[model samples]
Target: MTVDSSIMISFSTASKEYDNQTALRDITFMVEKGEMVFITGPSGSGKTTLLKLIYSAERPDSGHISVAGWDINNLKESTIPLLRRHIGVVFQDFRLLANRNIFDNVAMALRIRGAAEREIKTKVYESLKSVGLRHKSDSYPRNLSGGEQQRVVIARATVAEPNLLLADEPTGNLDADTAEGVMRIFKNINAKGTTIMIATHNKELYRNTGKKVIRLDSGNLVDVGKG
Candidate 1:
């Protein structure tokens, strides 16, 4: 199939398998630029695997996959970092550095990209302000509440202004109110034109959002439509 610039991600009959089990099977889908999409299912339904594929952490066993018009199936190792610059990932676990304060943690991405210190500081604060956490920049991750820690993760992920964001159960650890607050931050990010895809087994995360939801079951595409 021809690559379309507007399609931020595309899986043309892609499939992935682990030794004894299939994680995804002949899945075909597309996510357009600036859209927020959800991938939901029960436990072990390939939600995480799907996100890994997009992030290039894992590769599909068959068929094709592309992100922002780059053919993932044919991507070179040297080019992976370049592709990743356009994507931000929020892991299920808070992968914060124990020794670093919030400001340092949020500055890590920019530092790795060789951004100037002044530029890093500016972008990092803007990101933290966007997530309502600029006041907590001096605090350590261990001292913050779970919701606050998650907000820090969001700030760090968005500091580089990626074109796309992938979150794996972003609110899995929070109470309902905190989850709603985090969801609000995500919506604001999407409103600013970043394409987002969130993977969750929690139906409450997707229900009533009215965006598109892709459901998977035992490695099969069960449904693809509005949440």
Candidate 2:
């Protein structure tokens, strides 16, 4: 497929290594603006590693990596946070603050970015509503179910309206029904024009969603398949 000039993510010959083990091998791909794509593979197939590269948590050992036009491979330490503002990331582990309530946790991103109090309140509420967790606004993370906590994490990741959403096993901990619901929320967000790259092992989930699929095996990108 021809990559559009309006691409939001681009990785050319990207690779990552840890000591003697290679996490990714000469991988190359592009996610265009407003596209929803799935990244699937078995465990240790470099799905998480690919997400990390886009999020700037890990740099490529060789080759180029760019997101939203910024050169991630050459991005400076101080500019990492700046780059992250344009990308939302959801992890298998919901990284919510144990001490904070749902509203506070989701609003934390806006607070760090110095959003006004009124804007933060409005945006946080809307974000929570999108994930069907507005009713749990005052509840603590520990008091919520696994799916609820994951929803909160999703709200936090998307509250700022990021250009790209990188989700790694987002539905890994949810039940079948709940996972379907979460995937719908993701689809809704993607439909609104944000680019989405979901790394999952659930082929059924991707198939049901009808998004473009990119399969990986042992760090190599295999093929782009239809859902």
Candidate 3:
């Protein structure tokens, strides 16, 4: 397959196996820079596995994977950290530190990248504002509601303005209203040109979004079309 210059992620017939179980099978697709894509499937359908490959949590047993123009299929362990700096991740459960305040949690990403204290403060506040959580900067994660904590997680992930954001069931645990609110934050971030790929079971979130949809079934690509 031809690689497009604007492609931010490309999987060329990649396959991955966990022991005797196959997680993905010859998955070939490309995600353009700044595009928002959704992966949907039933339980154990490889949605999480695909996202793991892009972020280097797992490697394919065959074929190739390229992310941000880097040949990550064979990427060195030493360079994994370098690649992750440009990527952000959110999970079904909020992974914030209970001991840290909201501001500190959001600032952790920048601090890990060796950002200056003044700069980290500025960027963290801006990210919090974008997620509509600036008022809770001093509150701990345990003190906020589930939706509020998830928003804090989003703020933490985007504090550095990553090129790609991968979310796995980000709103899976929230109510309908809260889930819609979280998805709106994702749409707003995508509007700013950050590429986003979400693996979710909530079909309602993608119904009217007009985003690209990728369906996986039994480790195979069953469908690829726009919503």
Residues 1-227, candidate 2: write the lDDT tens digits. 23356989888899999896999998887788999999999999999999999999899999888889888877999999999999888877878999999999999989988899999999999999999999999999999999898889899999999999989899998899999898889989998999999999988788766678888999888987867
| Model 3 per-residue lDDT tens digits across residues 1-227 | 45677999999899998988989999988899999999999989999999989999898999899998778877999999889999999966677888999999999999999999999999999999988999999999989998898899899888999999999998888999999899999999999999999998789989978899999987888888887
TM-score of 3: 0.96
In model 3, which runs have C-alpha deviations exceeding 4 angstroms?
1-3
Taking every candidate in turn, the Cα RMSD to the unseen true structure, in Å, is 1.0, 2.0, 1.3
Error of 3 at 100 (Å): 1.4
**Clashes found in each candidate (C-alpha, N, C closer than 3 A):** 0, 0, 0
The global Cα lDDT (0 to 1) of model 3 is 0.91
Give all candidates' CA lDDT scores.
Answer: 0.92, 0.90, 0.91
Question: Which residue pairs clash within candidate 3?
Answer: none
* Model 2 CA deviation exceeding 4 Å by range: 1-5
